[model samples]
Target: MLIRLGYEIAIDCPQPMPVISLLDVHKDRQHDIKRQTKVLTSPFTACDVYEDSFGNSCRRYMAPQGGFQILYDALVEDSGEAEPCNPLAGETPVEALPPETIVFLLGSRYCETDHLSDLAWRLFGHVPPGWARVQAICDYVNNRLSFGYGYARATRTAAQAHEERVGVCRDFAHLAITLCRCMNIPARYVNGYLGDIGVPPDPAPMDFNAWFEAFLDGRWYTFDARHNVPRIGRVVVARGRDATDVPLLHSFGPHKLTTFKVWTYEQESYPVRPPARGIDRTLTTPLIG
Candidate 1:
């Protein structure tokens, strides 16, 4: 199936500011793109594109003072399959984990493995380790926290989200990732396009989604503590220790968001979308302008 994905975001700043954006699809999905518009901006500025440490495609450009806007549109092919479930994928012992996967087992900016280590054992020690344990964490998080756009907090950490028991999708990912790491599992944060492809349409305006991956049985497998069920049309753009590493946009200066909008759907279901919004504005450099 073909899916249309894009976003338009506008912000206001007091002065010109340098910003980096991770709006491009991940390199792994580059071959899946059927067509795309180069990331475009209002009041065009010079832009440099490069790969970040985690291999995520990144765009760097300076935003002019006042209102600035950035937009991207693309059509990508998908298998139209739901999230894969493999309860048989057993957890890898820490000593046997790949070097790269080791980083995911430690704490990061939003995921605090140290803070949640003891709690993780107390809550999950009895569960059979491996895929089932990961699913249990997802089940716990999905039921513990109330999800809503109003619960978003840019600075919230996994420990804080656990205590508050209220958060947006990122919080769910953070809390889940933290618990996985504490249990000696390699779990990393993921953010990307998740269209309402095989499910009913979401009435709320679309936004990039947050989830996580656990390295088990020699590979990283997708898991969403927020949804707690298999989902389809997940298009990954970046992965890292937490939201801090994969911020859709990071600005060097303060800015005020005046408008934001996002859209993702099967090509045939594309709507008449408004033209103001940006990708993952929930975590930044904030957004353009």
Candidate 2:
């Protein structure tokens, strides 16, 4: 199936500010692009594109005072299959896990594994380790937290979410990720385009979505605690230890989000074409704020 996805966002700045954006589709999905992903800026400036440490495509440029608008659109192919489910997938012992995967097992900005370690063992210690253990953590998060747009808080950590029992999708991901890390299951936060494709259209406005992935049986698998069901047409943009590492945009100076819109839906007649040349796949040190 073909899915059309992209966004139009604008920010108002009081002065020139250095900004980095993680709005492009992930490096892993570049081959699925049927239509080239093109990014345009209003009051155009030369935007330098690069790859971040996590392998996410990033754009960096100096934002001039006033409005900074960004636009991009693309047609990408999807398998039209629900996220894979493997209840029997086994977890590798911590000592046997790959060295690179060890970082995900540690606590990060939004997911404080240290604070939740005791509770995680208390609530999930009895569950059989491996896929069952991960599912149990998801089940607990799905039940404990109430999803509400109004409850969204950027600074909410996993422990706080567990205490308040309310937050947006990122909170669901953070809490699940933290619990998984505490259980020795490597997990990371992911944000992407998850539209209502094989389901009823939502009444609320569309926005970028958040989910998570867990390393199991030598590979990572996707999981969504907020929905707690297999979903289709997930076009991932970025992944990191938590939301702090993968926010859509980060600026050196204050900026107000003046416009935010995202779209991801089936495009029945999207044409497929060969990839263009000069697409760099290497990571570059970005001008960090």
Candidate 3:
């Protein structure tokens, strides 16, 4: 299916700010199941912007601003061409796992004690098959937690979310990632947009959204335990070991915030490109700190 995605983010600071930086991973990948037809990025004013690729081979863009507005737009075409089934079905389970996936499972900070991993294993014992394990964990998280604002800040961790049993999309994604990793399944945090299903159109944008992706069988599959539904309208900005790696916005120095908004919509009937193969081996220049 072809999709047109638009994303806008605004920050109203009490005072004119000194510096603003953005790390955007909004570009879609040409992979076994999806393709990128057209992509574009433009800032509202004069700013230094550069492109790079991260360890996972995802493309990234960095832009800087000061007490201002930032707009990002991308027109991508994704075909739902399915890839080969994950090869983990019959091989010795240990041999089927990827090295990166294993690292995420064992090395992520979220998998520490008293987190989702501990609770999930205590309740479910051993993980079932790939699909079954994901489904079971999804159901557990959805039933155990309630979605509400004011529970915690954006920086809250998976351990905090597990202790409180309440949080927004980010917390849910973090918890899910930790649980999947504990089961020896590779999972990562995703940042992006999810348009309101009921609200009328506002020229301004909406709030950012978060979800988790799991390496199942042999490929990454999207899951949103926060909504307890399959992925849609998930225009990914970045993917990382956790939320700390893919923040939608990061700022330094003190500045008062007046208002912020995000807007997104889907365009129908765009052109779709064929999937590209082979590892993406390009190196990324060090980001401006």
lDDT of each: 0.87, 0.88, 0.56
Better of 1 and 3 by TM-score: 1
Best by the lDDT measure? 2
Per-prediction TM-score to the true structure, in the order listed: 0.92, 0.93, 0.69
Better of 1 and 2 by lDDT: 2
The best candidate by TM-score is 2
lDDT of 1 by residue, 1-289 (tens): 8787778878898999998888888999989987666677887888999888888988998999988988777778888899788999998888888898888988899988888999999999999999999999999999999999999999999999999999999999999999999999999999999988877888887899999999889988999998888998899999989999999889999999887777777775323453234433442212212
What's the true lDDT of residue 174 in model 1? Answer: 96
Error of 1 at 145 (Å): 0.6
Summing lDDT over every window of 10 consecutive residues in candidate 1, give the lowest-scoring window. Answer: 280-289
Give candidate 3 regions above 4 Å deviation. 1-4, 12-25, 29-66, 78-96, 107-117, 196-205, 268-289
Q: Which stretches of candidate 1 lie over 4 Å from their true place?
A: 269-289
C-alpha displacement of 260 in model 1, angstroms? 1.2
Steric clash count of candidate 3: 8
Model 2 score (lDDT): 0.88
Instruction: Say which prediction, candidate 2 or candidate 3, comes out ahead on TM-score.
Output: 2
* Prediction 2 TM-score vs. true: 0.93
What digit string (tens of lDDT, one per residue) describes model 3 on residues 1-289? Answer: 4443433344544543444343344546423113222222233344444442333223232333434544334444444333233324421155677666665565455435344555768765565667777767778778767787667576567777777789887888887777777666777877776654333454433577888878765667778888875544455667778766665555544554433434444456433443333212121110100
